[model samples]
Each structure stands twice: as structure tokens, then as C-alpha cells.
Target: MNIRGKLIIIGGAVDKGSFTETDLDKNVSNNLNFFEAGILRRVLVEAKHQEKSRIEVITTASKIPREIGPEYIKALNYLGATNVDVLHIERREQATDPEVLERLKAADVVMFTGGDQLRLTSILGGSLFHDILLDKYQNEDFIYAGTSAGAAAASNNMIYQGSSHEALLKGEVKITSGLGLIDGVIIDTHFVQRGRIGRLFQSVVGNPRTLGIGLGEDTGLLITNNSRMEAIGSGLVILVDGRQIKDTNLTEIELGQPISVNNFAVHVLSKFDTYDLKTHKMHIQSSQYI
Candidate 1:
């Protein structure tokens, strides 16, 4: 099915004016705040209007929703947004609240913040709110944005648990169903900084038909039609294609065993680079994002 909405999947730590959290690797010396490299401004630009369009920041996955919600508001306000609001769906019952669904329906852009992906799926998945959101995104002029856990959970399949150190081992990476915003693709955040390439590889190797995307810190992809992906932000976006695999013992391997695979294709993209999910090819945009 073709989708009309936009998907902005970010790698997190994109200087929301109050962003100071370290990535999965605990790197404290990130030099991203000094310039205009953050993707929040692009989020505002992606919306229909800066002043009038309502942008809803959903913080269901965040443990500190009260804190993260306001940070997004501050960041969007800085980008000239005047009609921004925060929604914290703390429980399953809250997902079915009439007022909450109405608020979401009125929003032009709904962004999911970084946190626990499981919380988002368990709480909002299969609910009336999810139905409305999916319907609106596929039919209306809406935008769906997410960072970190939000980005990971936006896909139909999610990697809920996996350590970078043991990702290459069979069965080390655990997968689960997500919000079902997009399919035939898997997303992994903090790819460069956290060394999560292995898990993404395992994800694609397990299912060669699936494409894996690894987003670096402060980087993302602006996806449209659920097929065309334009790279955004300062860091890198890696694509893992396992469609050409010739030989592999992944199915025969036991738990914790190192699975081997051949002919895994990889692509590294920067800002402005566009990828076609249908063709499995990337188009380069000469203009530098930095």
C-alpha cells in the first residue's frame, strides 16, 4: 500500500536545545550543539506550516515523558513553531482516551520521542488510537517523525534487545513487532557511535527480503511514499541489503553460535542522499549538508 505521510526517523541526540544525554556508547565529547546540524528545524519545515500547523510530540516510550516532552516543544518553538503540544500515553487505557485520539487527529505532525520501543508498541499498538494514526498517515497530509527508540519501533519489525558486543552471534538479537508504520525494513539507531551494525546485519540476514537501516547519532532519513528515503542530519545512514546472499548457516547454527553469511551488501549515505526501497539503489545529491 502506498502511504501519503512523511517519516522522519532520527538517530537521536540532535540538539533539541536541552539535549545533553550521551549515546549508547557514552560518548561525552559530541560537538553537534554549536552549529545548526540538528534535524528539529527540518521537522518544522516538513510540517504544512510553522505557525499554524499543530505538532504533537508523543512521549509514550520515554520513561521521563514530562521532561522529554517539554524539550521537544522548546526545540520546535525555537524553530518558529507556535502550535506544538505534548502527549504522554503512560498506560494502555490512555491510548483509548477520546480526547487523546482527537488531539492526535488534529495534529499535522506527530513525533515519537526516544525511549523504550516496547512501551510504545505494548501501549499504543492495536488500539483505536493506532488505527486512527495508521488511517490518517496513509490517507491524509500528515507527518510521522521519530527518534532513537521511536525510529526503531516505527517499522513493523523491531529489535527490542541486542548488545553490540554479542550481536554477531545467532539468537543474540531479539526481534519483535512494532507500530507497523513501515514494513519490509528494520531500523537500528545509534549505529555509528554504538557499533550496532552487527545486529542490523543479523536482522537482514535472518530475512534477506528485509532491508536494514542503521542511523548514526544526530542523523536520520526523510522517508516519503514509504519507499523513497532522503538522508538528513549530520551523521551517516547505513543500509544493509541481504538479498544477494549465496550461502549461510544461520538456520543451522545454535544459540550463541556465530552465524556466517556471504554477499551482504552495504551502503553508506550522508545528508541529501536518496535511496529507493523498491530498486535497492541510492542516488547521490551533490550538495553537502555540512
Candidate 2:
């Protein structure tokens, strides 16, 4: 099935104008606020729902919904998205609320914030809200944007918990069913900054058919048709392709033992780099940089 909607999967730590003078460094001081230049702003502009597009910000993944929800609202509003609403559906019952569903259906864009991916699936899974999300994604032109845990929850195979140190060891990474907005893929957030390449590599090794995307902080992937993805933001994204794996010791290794794999292709992409999910090929157009 061809995906009709667009997805903006972002890494965590998006700047929100809350950076203090002490936090300003060479890497951050030169960048615009999250609402101004990063993935968030890109999503708002790309949505193109209308002038002043209506956006539904789902803060289900966040433990501190109250804090995160308002931050997003303020940022969106700053970016001229005046019709932004926060859907703090923390419980299963709220996920089925008529008002909540109405808000979701009417919105031009829906965004998920960073937090616990498990909470998002647990609360909204099998609910009418989730069904609507899936339906809209396949049939409508709505925009779905997520960051951190939100990005991780966009795939069928979700990486809930895993430490970078133990990523190479057998059975170190935990995989669970996600919302399945984007299939045949696994997503890991805060990639480069947190050194999560190992975990992403493990995920791809376990599910060779599924592509692994490791999103770095302040970075994002603009996914369309569920097949093509374009890198956005200043940071990098790591793509791990295990389809050509020639050999591996994963099956023979016991729990806690380090495993090895051969012919695992890894690609590091920056802004403007594009990837084909089905072909597993990257296209770096010179015009994109010009």
C-alpha cells in the first residue's frame, strides 16, 4: 500500500528558546530556535494544510505532558501556527473520547512529543484514535510529526529500552510493537549524541528486512510514501542496512555474549541526503546543496 501522508521523524533535544547563556556553545549558539529553523518549523511549513494550519499536538508519550504540551503550543504559535491544540490523552479512556477524536480528525497536522514510546502505544493502541491515525496516514494528506520517543513509535518494531554499552551483546535491545505508522522499519532517536548506533545495528541484524534509522539530536527525516526519506536539520542520521549480511554469530551466541555480523552496510547522512527504503540506496543530489 502506498502511503499518502508525510512523516517528520525528529531526534530529541530540539531547541525551544529555553537555552540560557551558559548553554550557548559553538555548536548551538549559531543555530536558530527549534521553532525557527529546525524540524519543527520545517514540519509546519511542509504541512501546507492552509494559512494558519490547525495542529493537534499529542503529548501522550511525555511523562510531563503539562510542561511539554505548552512548550510545543508556544513554539508553534511563534511560528504562526495559531490553531494548535494539545491532546493530553494520558489514559486509555481519554483516547476514545469523542472530543479527542474530533480534534484529531479536524487537524491538518498531528505531532507527537518526546518521552516514553511505551506509554504512547499502551494508551492509544487498539483505540479509535490510533485507528483514525492509521486511516488518515494511508488516505489523507495530513502531516504526522514526531520527535524522540515519538519517532521511535512510528514503526512496527519499536526499540523501547536498550543501553549503548550493551548494544552489541545478545538480547540487550528490547523490541516491541509500535503504532505502525511506518512499517518495515525500526527507529532510534538521539542517535549520534547518545552513541546509539550499536543498538540500531542490533535491531537491523535481528530484523534484517526492516531498515534501521538512527536519528541524531536536532536532526530529522522527512518520510514520504513510506519509501523515500530525506534528511533535514543540522545534525546527521545513520541508516543501517543488513540485507546483504554474509555471516553472523548472533544465532550461535548465548545471552550476554558479543555477536558479530559481516557485510552490514552503514550510511551516515546529513541535510539534503535522500534514501530509498525499498532499494536501500542513497541519492545525494548536488543541486540540494546548491
Candidate 3:
């Protein structure tokens, strides 16, 4: 299926804001500042209507929707986004609300804030809202963007549970079905800051056919035409390729035991780097400072 839409999978920022000015700046040295930096602004610019686009920020994954939702609105509003609103769909019933469906239908970009990826998959999966989102992403020039846990749930396969420390142990990294927007890929956020490389490694080694994407803080990928991804923001994007793995003990290793995988290919991508999803290729351009 040829997709006509785009995906912006962000590495997340300081989204657990308690409604303070420090909410977005608490981890500025390690987090993506959507307004001052490029991720959120890029989301607006990618929209067909720019700041006028009807953007819906989904807070289904956030426990404190009251805090996270308005903060996003405040940030986008600062960027001159006129029609942005927060959709605090905490209950499953809200997934089928006519008003929610209407707003979704009229939206140019849907942004998913960080929280619990499992909460998002459990509540919205198979709902009419999810149906429309999938259809729009496949048929229209729509945008589906997510950050942190939202980024993890953007793919068909999601990693909901896994400790960064024990991720390499067999049976440690848990996997589940996601929103199914993109196939054959798994996305992990706060890669560098959280040291989640082991989690991603265990994930891809278990399912070598799937591509593992580790997004660093203050970084993201602007995936256009559904296949070409341009690394955006100010950090690194790690591409873990398990397609060439020569051997792995994941299939035979006992629970809590270490697993081994050989021939795994990894790529470290920085800003201005491009990767072809369809061909599994990475293209790095000359450094701007060089």
C-alpha cells in the first residue's frame, strides 16, 4: 500500500510538565525543546495549512492530561498555530465519540504526547478513531506525529515494557502490537539519554525482520512519502539492522539468560542524514560545519 501521508517520530521532551516554565526546560540540555528547536515547528510547517492547520494533540497516553495537554497548546500557540486543541481521550468510549471523529476528520496533523504506550494501544486500537487515522495516513496527505511513548506506539510493533539495563536478557524486552500506522519497524525514544540501545537490540534480534529505530533526545525523523526519512532536530538517530544477523540465541535462550546476536548492522544518524526505509539505505551528507 502506497502511503500519502507522513510520520514525525520524536525522541520526546520534558513533557511531564507540572505547568511550570521549567516543565519544558527541566531537561533542556538532554530534551527536545519543541518551540525553540525544530521538532514541533516542523510539525506545523509540514501541515498543509501551516499554523492554520487543525491540529489535535492527543493526550490519551498522559496521566495528567490537564497539565500536558494545555502545555502543548501553549507551545504551539506561541508558534502562531491558530486551531490547535487538546483531545483528552482517557476513556475508551471517547474513541468513538462523534465530535472526536469529526475533529479527527478535519485535522491536518494529529500529535500524540508522551506517557504510556500501552495505554494508547489498549484504548484506541481497533476503534473508529484509529480506523480513520489509519485511513487518512494511507490515503491523504496527513501527518501522524508522536513523541516519547507516543513515538514508541507509532509503529505496528511496540515495545511497552523493558528495562534499559535488562533489555539484553532473554524475555526481558516485551513486545506488543501498536497503532499499525507503519509496518516492519519499532521506534524507541530517549535512546541516548536513557541508554535504551540494549532494549532496541533485544527487540530487533528477536524479530530480525523488523527494523529498530532509536531516537535520541532533542532528535527525530521527518519521514516523507512514507519511505524517505530525514533526521531532524539536534541529536542522533540509531538504526539497528538485524536483517543480516548470522546467529542469535534468542530462540533457544532460557528466560533471564543472556542472548547473542552476530552480524547486526547499526547506523548512527545525525541531523541532515537521510535513510531510505524501502531500501534500507543510509545517506549521510557533508557536515554543515565542515
Off by over 4 Å in 3: 14-19, 22-37, 287-290
lDDT: which is higher, 2 or 3? 3
Candidate 2 stretches with Cα past 4 Å from truth are 19-36, 287-290
- Candidate 2 lowest-lDDT run of ten: 25-34
How does each model score on lDDT? 0.88, 0.87, 0.88
lDDT string for model 3 (146-203, tens) is 9998889989999999999999999998999999888888999999999999999999
Error of 3 at 43 (Å): 0.8
* Residue runs of model 1 more than 4 Å from their true location after superposition: 19-37, 287-290
What TM-score against the true fold does each predicted structure earn? Answer: 0.92, 0.92, 0.92
Candidate 2's C-alpha lDDT?
0.87
